[model samples]
Target chain A: MVQLSACLLRKIPGPPRIYKRLQTFRLNARYEGRSRNCYVVGQGYQLKSMQYTRVARKNKVLDFKELYNLRLEAAAEEHGIPFRYLWDGLRRMNILLNRKVLQDIAIYEPRTFAGFCELSKQHQVDQGLNLPPHSYPKIPVNTKGML
Target chain B: MHDRRRVLQWATFARSWWIFDANHQCPFQSANRLCLFLEGKHKPIYHPLSDCGDHVIVINTKHIAMPDRFWRAWRHFHHTQYAGGFQVQRAWQVHREDPTKILKKQIYSTLTGNLLRKGLMARLHLFPEEDVPEGMLRNVSNQIRQVMPVPKTLEDYPIEERESFPRVFEWPEEYVVKDGKEFERQKEYLDEDLSLSKLQ
Candidate 1:
C-alpha cells in the first residue's frame, strides 16, 4: 500500500478534528450490533463486518465533496501519475472517470493512462486554437471592403 | 560455468528454506531472515541474466492488514465495456476471492520489467488455509509463532469515535433493510407495491 507522505497530507488541509471524531462515533454506532468477526482468517483478521458497514454507511450519507477529495488522492497514487496531471486530465476530459477506474489503471495498466494524457493534451491544444496560422508571411494585406 | 554454479547454489539455498521445522512458524522471517537475508539486488553474485532469488511459500494469504484508513477508502474497478460499463469493488473483495493475487501483484509491481519476473513469480506459493500441499509436509510440526499485536492508531479506531462518519441511512432516500424481521416485512410491502403499480 502506498503511504501518503507527510508533505502531501500537509498540502490537503484536513477537516476539523472534532468533525472527524464525530464521524468515527457515528460509524461505530451504526455497526454496534453487527458481527465484527465475520471475515477473520487464520491468526489475523480478514475483512471485518464493521469496516464494510462503516464504508457503506459513509457512502450513502456523506456528500460527494469528501468522497471526491478522497478519490483525487486515490487517483494520484493508483495511477502512479502526479496529482496535478490527474487534476488537469479530469478537467480536460470533461468526463468523470471515477476514483476506482483511475486507481486500477494506476496499478495495473499505466501505459494506457499515458495514452489518455496525450489525447487530453491534444484536445486542449485544438480547443485553444481560434484560427490557423498562415504558412507564408502576409504580403502587405489591404482590406478592400473596409476601404 | 562459474555463473551457473553460483545460480545453482542460490537456488539450492532457497529450496532448503522450504522445510518446516518445530521452532519456526514462518522460517523465512524468523530462522532464516527470509525477508532480510535473501539479498537479490544487493548481492555481487546477482546477475540480471537470471532470477536468482529464493522461492517464497506463504502459508496464509488472507490475513495481511493495511495501515489505518486504507480499508475504508480504497476502491478498485473493472471495466465491462458494454451498457453497464464499469463495475467498482473494494480491495477487501479482491483479497477475499484470491489472496495470492495481492502478493503476486505487489511482487510484480516491484520487479523490473523483464522476463525474469515471470520465472520468479512462478516460484511463489500462496495458500489461503493452514493445509500445506501433500507430500510437502514431511514430519513437520506446526509450531505457530506468537505475533506481537500492535495497538490501533487514532485513525484505526472504530468509526463511532470519528465525527465525520456519516449516518446509516440519510433522510429522503428510500432504502430497504435486509437480513432481519424488518427485511421480511419490507419484502412483502415491496411486492405489494409492485403488484399495485402493475394493476394501475
Candidate 2:
C-alpha cells in the first residue's frame, strides 16, 4: 500500500507557477466569455479586469452618493437653504442623518424634510453665517423706475 | 373636477407679490422674515430647484430702524481690488450713501448661496421711501406683517385720550407745579448746546 501511494505521488508532476496562473486566467476568461463577449484570455488581462471591476464597483457607490446629494439639494432648496448650508448645519447641530437616509426622507416624508431644512436655516441664522461675496448681484439700477 | 384641479394647480404655482412697510421696523429681523417668502418657504409646494418664490416690494427703507447703536458701530467693508483699496464705513455712513443698502445686505446675507440667488434677489423691490413706482405698486396683491410693531409715541396719542386717562391721585391745592417752568429752562439749555455744537 505504501509503494502504491508513493508511485501515485511521483506520477503527479508539480506544475510551474505560470501554468497555475494560466489555468486561473483560462477559468476567468471562460467565465467572462460566457457572461460577457470579450475573451482576452491571459494572466495580465485577468488581473487588469479584476482591478477594473473593483474600481467600477467603487465608482458606482460614489455615483449613488452624488445622486443622493443632488436629490437632497433639490429638496433643501424648496425649504429655502442650499445643500451645502443644510449639510453644514446638520454637521454643526450633530443631526447625524446620512445622505441616503436624508434623501429618502426628502422623498417619502417631504414635510419632515422641510422641517430639517428649516432647522438648518435657523441654525445658520443663529450662527450668523453669511454666503460668499458676490454670491448674489446688487439691486438693479432703476433710473426708469419701471419695476 | 378635473378643471378645478387644473386651476388649483396653476394657483399653487403662481407667483404672488407681497408688500412690506419697512417704516420703524428692524431691518435685520424684517430681512429674516422676508427671506422666507423670497425662497418660497411660505408655500406648501416650494421646491428649491423650481422658480416658485414670490415677489416682494419693500417701501420706506429710508425709515428702517437699527437696533441699539448699530448705525454708528456696525461697519460695512469694501475692497476695490487695488493695492491699499480696503475701505470700511460705519452703518450710518453706508445708509447715508444708500438708504436701502443695509436692509438689502441683511436680506442678501440671509438667502442661501445658489444659482437662483440672483434671480430671487431680483424679485425684491426696495424703495428708499414710501414712493414705490406705480407699475410695481399695481402688482402687489398681499401685505407682509411687520416683524415688530411700531412703538406709539406720545404724539401718536390723541389729546382726548391723554386727558381722559384716569388720574391715580389728586394733588393738594397748595402743591406747587415746579416742573413746568424747569422743563422750559432745560429746553433752552439743550437748544444752546445744539447751537454751540453746530458752531464748532
Candidate 3:
C-alpha cells in the first residue's frame, strides 16, 4: 500500500519528493501521538517540502526582477531619463540583455552602462518617444512660435 | 579596466547636495521626506552599512505649518539624564524658543537610531529663513520638491492676470453680506419685523 501511494504521488508534475519508510522502526520504539506515527511524519515532511519549494521557486524570480528594475530605475534617473524610455530604447535597438545583466553592468561597468543610457536617449529623441504624454497639446502657447 | 573602475567608484559614492524649501510645509511630514535624503534611502545604492547619504539644506523653517491643534496639543519631551531633568513643551513653545528646533527635532526622531545618526545629522543644514551662507548655498546641486504647494494670496497675482480671470457671474454691488455693518443691521430689522407680526 505504501509503495503504491508513493508511486502515485511521484507522478504529479512538480519538484521531486523522496519517499522512504526507514523511520518506521524508530516510530515503533516510541508511543508518541498516534498508531501510524512514521506514516504521518513522512506525509508531513513531504507536504511541507513541496509547499516550500513551490513558493520559493515562484517568488525568487519575481523578487530578483524587482531588485533589478529598482537598480535600473536609480541608474537611469541619474542620467535624467526615465527607466521606461531606457527599456523601450534597448528593446528597439536589439541590445537583447535581460534586466539582471543590465543591472550588473550598471554597477560594475558604470561607464558602459552610461553609454547605454546615452544611446537610448538619442534613440528616444530621434523617434520622438521623449515627448510629453498624448494628453498634452502638441504645441504649447509659449513654444508655438519657436517651432 | 582599472582606470574605468576607479572613475566609477568615485561617481557612484560621490555625495550630492540637496536643498529643500520648507515654507508652508508641515514639520512632521517634511521630516518624513527629508529623512530619506539624510539617510541616503532615496538612492538605490542605500544599505544600512553604507554611509552614502547626501547633504540637505533646509530653508524657511520659520514658515513650517502644523496641522490644526497640533501647535498647542503636541508635546515634545526631553530628558537631560539627570535628577528632575525631564521636561515637556508644546510644539509652538519649542518653535518660539528656536524657529528651527521643531524641524530639527522632527528629523532627528525620524532617523534610525544607529551609530551613524550623529554623522547623518551633521550633513543637515537648517536655516530659519532664506538667508543661507554663501559657501553653503554654492554647494547645492539639486532641490527636493516641497511636500505641499505654497498657497497664493490675492496680492501674489498680477493685476493683469487677476482682471483676465474668467468668472461665471459677479456679486451684485448691493449684496447685504458684502458690507459687514449693513448685513448686521438688516438682520436685526428682519428680526424686529418678525417679532412685531408675532405680537399682533
Q: Best TM-score goes to which candidate? A: 3
Candidate with the larger lDDT of 1 and 3 = 3
- The candidate with the higher DockQ, 1 or 2, is 2
Going through the candidates in order, what is chain B's TM-score? 0.49, 0.79, 0.76
Q: Which regions of candidate 2 are displaced past 4 Å?
A: A1-147, B163-200
* Tens-digit lDDT string for candidate 1 (A1-147): 354776665456677776654544443443433322222121122235456667888786555444444434443423233345545656766757865565455434656655554444344344452211221112322323221
For candidate 1 chain B, which ten residues in a row score worst on lDDT?
B19-28
Better of 2 and 3 by DockQ: 3
Which regions of candidate 1 are displaced past 4 Å? A1-147, B1-39, B42-44, B80-84, B137-200
Model 1: what TM-score? 0.32
Model 3 DockQ vs. reference: 0.21
For model 3, how big is the iRMS in angstroms? 2.5
Estimate the TM-score of every prediction.
0.32, 0.51, 0.54
Worst 10 residues of 3 chain B by lDDT: B191-200
Q: What's the residue-level lDDT of A114 in candidate 1?
A: 52
Sort by lDDT, top down from the best: 3, 2, 1
lDDT of 2 by residue, A28-85 (tens): 7555443333333455566777899999999999987766775676677555566887
Which regions of candidate 3 fall more than 4 Å away from where they truly are? A1-102, A105-147, B1-5, B81-85, B159-200
